[model samples]
Target: MRYNKLDLNLLVALDALLTECNISRAGERVHLSQPAMSNALSRLRNYFGDDLLVPVGRHMERTPRAEVLREAVRDVLVRIETSVATQPEFDSRDTDRTFKLFVSDYSMEVLIPHVLAIADAMGSRAKLHLRPQSSNPARDLERGEADLLLIPGEWCSAEHPSRVLFDDELVCVVWSGSRHAQQGISIDSYATAGHVAMQPIEINEPAFEQWIQAGVGAPRDVRAAATSFAVLPFLVVGSELIATMHARLARLVEPALPIKRMAVPFPLPPIHQAMQWHKYRNLDPGLVWLRDLMIAAAQRM
Candidate 1:
């Protein structure tokens, strides 16, 4: 279909359906009465030549076509909203909007206290919603399920606007007075030690394949493989298992736990944490303000 032939209003209705995933809820999101929403859905169906949403058991399920269009529709609406709407001035001192952020548990352990301190000092009324980082970041942003994503720079996509929050080096953490903390950690020693393993960002098994291929070894001695980075230090502190995590997080967790950072026996790269937002939000005033606040919080940390 030609761009000129498409009705922009239909895009808004489509965005609502995609966000709410229910006709009634979608109607409410767009401020259309139930009957009007049904009519709009009908019109959308005719225009798209497909049932955008189909009843599946008790809930509405998106059609393949609808799923494919979801991101595009969301992007378009976000662009329009940013383009036409006046940006609201965000006063952290009095605003009540809740900001949803996706971050690794490890990040929260280190970053939350500092962020809260900033909020406290600013006397902001906004609340922060922190969710664990999932494998699907693009989906979260498009659905409005996540307002912002916190991730390592290696995982960030240029499709989204990003700002580097800080750089962190790797450290091997073990119990403060544990034998491992006082002993040498040669490559073989590390390879043979029991450890708890985790990655701050989601990684596939194949990515680790390259390391194993490069004469580098795997954590063959891992007692447990956890999906959350935040749990690594705790697991290390409570057990004999050693965990390799970011230096910043290690520092944040050290005071509260019986863990110590030891020099890595082998070479590793430093990790960088960054805040990412969809480009569609580039011009939205409220989002801009919130982004600045997040950056400021990171700086203070």
Candidate 2:
């Protein structure tokens, strides 16, 4: 369709182009051929009377105009998708909507299975795509790149609406044959033990336990670090390393792995796992149904 002598289809091309900043990658995103994408870019440049993307050394960089249009274009597309493209009513059994969610490895192991089971029991045909939690999940929610986010309560975006799904406490995990298991963990031992810590790949900050330990002025001898919480138990197995992780995750992995879980020797606050959504999607029927399903699953957990 044409609006004010401009082809509206070019907007989709422009969004992908500006976001990716690579012609080939942008073409792949929109499933267009390289030649087609190049043509779209040329037409866009002619329409806008400026080059949106220019080469910067080995990489492509967005021009000043492109930077200004980036967020505005994303907002326009999100508004159209949510307000104009969505159906007025939602029926779980009949509708086939794909819900994208950003979740931590902890939630993937302890909570997502329950959610899938509940969805199956309800005979819903909705598909779920679980993406690994990124450093900036609030940005993903704002751009409508994800339908929901499952994260710690403190990390949730204040501009959006969120509900506390469940609360979990931290626990200390050690090898079943380790000396700490036989003698039990004390504050001194916990601080002095060789620890296997978690530092997710997407984040640059310290893990939750590390922050608490820092506040208490206790330092740990971190022997190793892993990107996934699920790997912490394996790293602790057959070794003297101690891992402080979520209680629910520890319990889930304890049956199969030769690991023992004990209470943290120091005082630690509970982790409130929350579900967040874009504020603009507050009344989206599909999102409402999905949120209800998530809440029901969390209650079961």
Candidate 3:
């Protein structure tokens, strides 16, 4: 259990140190006393003949050599943890890992409640962290910073493997007593009516509707724009303004607001919510279980 006359135990300490970059934090992670962790670091430095961690203004930063070894060390530890340290079957109730997901607020509302409730009921110590999605989801997945991306079909890329979670259509919502509701929407009426819309989100391409409309110049009028779908209900309630959004999200907030969901006056393409993950983690058992659980949650919804 030795490498280059260095004890194998040093690798565990090294992994923790490289991951955390702080002696105290690394010690806490691996259950070592601070002094013991320091000794482990000294031994590693002696073996590698380099300062693996350099002190920097009350913080520790990994040296270039340590940075070079970080992924290899972490991967080795993960392999051992996955193949040897734990039971053959992933014991969700006993796992203490955290999963990072890239998702927007609407997807979070739909998935987290169902998924976490099930995990909590099973006595799981695992935690799910959602990062508000940005335009660079594909890159985030490739870099392993995100475990999964829950995104609309238009924004998703086929560069990564994906599973369709659910399909949804856009619906125009108006206040229950609005003119659009009472008089019914015609093409001309729909074109002239004041509308609230979600601002464009795509970075590389135009939104689905934008692409479809091409040169039509966006229907007739946009009275207001909101950054998130969650604001649609509040923005439309008791107002004559109409807002178009995903039907499922419209349903989620419909009961809370005096609003009615009606088909969009024009035929629009359907959008799907899908789960996408890195090719590197596609077969990871814990992630596979999580993906399956998410699919199940979507089905139930």
Candidate 4:
């Protein structure tokens, strides 16, 4: 497509250039060679009569004109994307589109079963690409790399529209033969107890008190630390270390781990698991159908 003798595709290059400010990085984002991106930038500069990107020290910086165009360009592109998407005929039962989901470990264990069950009932060949959520999930959605993000509501970005799927609570997980199992976990016991710390990297929202940003009452003595929740079983059992995890996760994995679940003596805030999507995708029928399906699964969970 051409607009005023301009290859409209260069608008994509312009968006990337203004966003990244580095020619090489912009080229990588748009799948263009550095030289090709440079050429496109030259054309854009000639057309707009502005040095859109300027070399500052060793880094590239957007010019004042580029800064002014940043949000304008983004808005224009989002409008274009929404317009194009609204023209598609998307029927969930007949569509074979693949959706990429950034799902947290807890959600994957407790809620993914319901999502898959509903998908099967829909008689659709739609495939789900499940990936571990990154620290910056909102950016992932904005870049169109992920179709949906399943995370706690607090972590959801205002940039995208989101809805709560379900609420979960923290619970104490102990070996079936542990003292806490026979008795109960009290505030004093919890504070003095040697606890298993499941330290998560690049996580903004944690389902339990093990991680920072969610702890309320008191801190526990960190006896052992594990990277993922999957390793909690090994670290919790056969040791004096007690573990804390989501109530739903503990109940689901109870029979297999020889673990007993108990309510925390001190109340923890309820975590609202939410499903969020890009605002640009609001008018996309395919995405709307999937969002509705996800909401339904959340309700069932």
How large is the C-alpha RMSD of every model relative to the true structure? 3.8, 1.9, 5.5, 3.4
Q: After superposition, how far is residue 116 of candidate 2 from its true place, in Å?
A: 0.8
Off by over 4 Å in 4: 1-7, 17-34, 45-72, 205-217
State TM-scores per candidate: 0.81, 0.93, 0.69, 0.82
User: lDDT rank, highest first?
Assistant: 2, 4, 3, 1
Runs of candidate 1 with Cα error greater than 4 angstroms are 1-10, 19-39, 54-64, 86-88, 199-215
Candidate 2 at 180: error in angstroms? 1.4
How do the residues 62-177 of candidate 1 rate in per-residue lDDT, one tens digit apiece?
99999899988877666665576634565667777777898877678777778888878878787888888888776777666677888777767767788888877777889877
lDDT of 3 at 148: 85
In model 2, where is the ten-residue run with the lowest total lDDT? 204-213
Candidate with the larger lDDT of 1 and 3: 3
Full-model lDDT for every candidate: 0.75, 0.89, 0.78, 0.81
Give the runs in model 3 whose Cα sits over 4 Å from its true position: 1-89, 200-206, 211-220
lDDT of residue 235 for candidate 3: 87
Pairs that clash in candidate 2: none
Scored by Cα lDDT, where does model 3 land?
0.78
Best by lDDT: 2
